[model samples]
Target: MDRRVLFATLILLAGGATGVGVALFAFVGVDDATTETTVVWESEPAAGDDGSGAAVATVDGDPLLLRPAVENGSRVVRATVAGGDETTWTVPISGPDAERGGGDANGSDGDPSGVSGLTTGTLGGDPVAALTTAPGELVVVDAADGTERFAVDIGGPGGLRPAIGDLTGDGTPEVAAVGTDGSVRVVDGEGDSVTEASLSGDIDRRPLVVEPDAEAGERGGIAVMTTTGDPATVHLLDETGEARWTTTPNVNPYSWNAADSRDGSVLVLGGTSGNIEAVETGDGSDRYEVGLQDLPVEVGDADPGTVYVGGSGSVWAVDLLDGEVVWKQQYGASTRINEPGVGDTDGDGELAPVVVNRAGEVLAMTQRGKVTARGGPDAVVYGGPLFADVTGDGGDEVIVVADDGTAIAADT
Candidate 1:
């Protein structure tokens, strides 16, 4: 099994927390030193009306997408699949501790003492999470059952979360977090510090993983953007937290998302300035730029050669080779769209654009940028909607959490 989810190949359910029934993989607390997982699922075609394919992307088989939902003081992973009748599951997370942060994800025989949940990621080739067990501590929790695998202290009062990936191409991913001090910290599996690279002045955005060349596999680097600098720098760091290249993207970037260029050789970043720039991965040289409007908040690739960028009122399909706006659509001034998730919403052989806004609006748009299926004000969405198939039912669904802690799964 590889460190990253084989989204390009197959979804492997090999490791997780210990649990039973309906096929699950779970884990125990770090203090308990127990590792196990139980999973039960049957692979079928992706879900849709005709059951032709799924609305969301998949590997060889269907894999559940984990969403952290908080209620009162308790947080759980809400796994859902949309189509026909919906299926859902929950895994409890551990909370704060006195001396050192520690607790079983199954709680007190299935309940915990805390209110927070884990951020989903891949650990040891299975679904896992990076959780903030304490104010200055980060813990790795198995997504299968919320068991703490290991805990590492990441000094932070600003509460910025960490990103995990196979930074070393060793089939074992590392946890990387940008501390409040504008430094990026790397932690290995056993809760040990691997590297701490400080390059920018005031880091404001999250760190994204980019492989300069998509074929680079786990050999790629992390992209960290800074809010305040002489020229607003974006540092591309190698596996050891070393800066491989740095570029000044913009002065006042409202929002930006990174995706692979069409040919998989460069990094294409879409910013709110309505500018999409492709930068060389080797030396941070200028490649090309495309201009689009409505503040392109989220950018991604569902196909190998096309990049989809969406905002509050518009979505554009850009050609990877020449940076041309191949297709586009606009909603309305009253509509607020942000990021996009890819799915075969209308059972099209190719993937389409799916987006949500702060108002909880969910829309599945066709390849030509027309609304196919419209649903929700389901959750007060501040970001792009997440797509997954949790029910083993085949079809893909949209997962959203409201401002009031309401978690809902809507059909795509």
Candidate 2:
């Protein structure tokens, strides 16, 4: 029998015993046998919802899955745990009486508010959810109870995300947001602007906060990329909101957010430019550029020396130092892959990079780019995947949200 057919048959058999259905059509021609997977839990879709991405947060010493969505004509953040405890916090994106759009809500003509980013961080030593809403707003809520901690205008039409770091070297994390006007605003726990700096050209991506390295003699800084034109410029700002150095890379506006190399010595950037460029963090100089196909939607650090680039239908693991492609996995045409999350999803004491496509197919690949496991929500997925030990089993669970707003956690 064909290997693919045999793998599917085995999955069906295993799933049958659990009253679950396993379909491996997405890996029909793949050579490796699929690993057994179980759906740990599934949350119902929110009413009048489009989609959401999952972020893990610690609430009262417990890990919770945070899903930010525009549901039922309101912008809200939903928190859930593996044991099924859930809380929904309605965010006042505009105002209570302001027109909201989404789901089946009446009296709304505006488009549904887009969740540009969802991240968890500390605000004055308390856990908080920083949610960026479309059209320009950053709403911070208490992670434990969904209470509105604070909200600040991010200044722009939207699409910019926030980064959390210590801008004052005070041991407390501050929020950094880039306005469309090219200004980076560092806000404190009280929602006050700690410092504001400007970059040339308009900015749309999240600002990267680089921490100081004492041993490397590297002073930490904030990095922002310009998205107004080709050959985009990258600016590195100091702790005092001053520009240190700026370099232009052969990149375009249609790029994902840049990521810092493991040692914080190089910044890796990828996008529609069809290449990954590594910029030296010390002086903002180009280190190396590796060509790639397909437009990259996200870039993430895989291991110490390798970074994974996720694009349409494929993911590439490239060596950071030499710009060499270590391994590349292709998922065929018409598949849109989100940024992959790395963890030991199989609890084998070895880390693997897991990716989810728009078709809702989840694939966990070995460090060498071989598919080690295959599972999914079996629904259309619009958000990137998040890894966390939601089951408190000390093993990470891959969580993804479907287009209908259902959040699914699967264990392999």
The prediction achieving the highest TM-score against the true structure is 2
Global lDDT of each candidate: 0.51, 0.65
Model 2: lDDT to the true structure:
0.65
Q: TM-score for every candidate vs. truth? A: 0.69, 0.81
Candidate 2 has which clashing residue pairs, if any? Answer: 48-103
> Model 1 over residues 1-412: C-alpha lDDT tens digits?
2232111222212122122001111111111121211122222221101110012223235544444444344644444433223334555545533221122111101122222233466666666666443355566666555466786655552234456776666667788766545667778776688777776476655566653333654247777777556546778898777888788864235444455554455656665555666666667776666556534345655455666766557666666666656555554344556556676533435677776666666666666554555557534444455555544455555555444333445665
Compared to the true structure, candidate 1 yields what TM-score? 0.69
Give the root-mean-square deviation of each candidate in angstroms. Answer: 16.0, 9.4
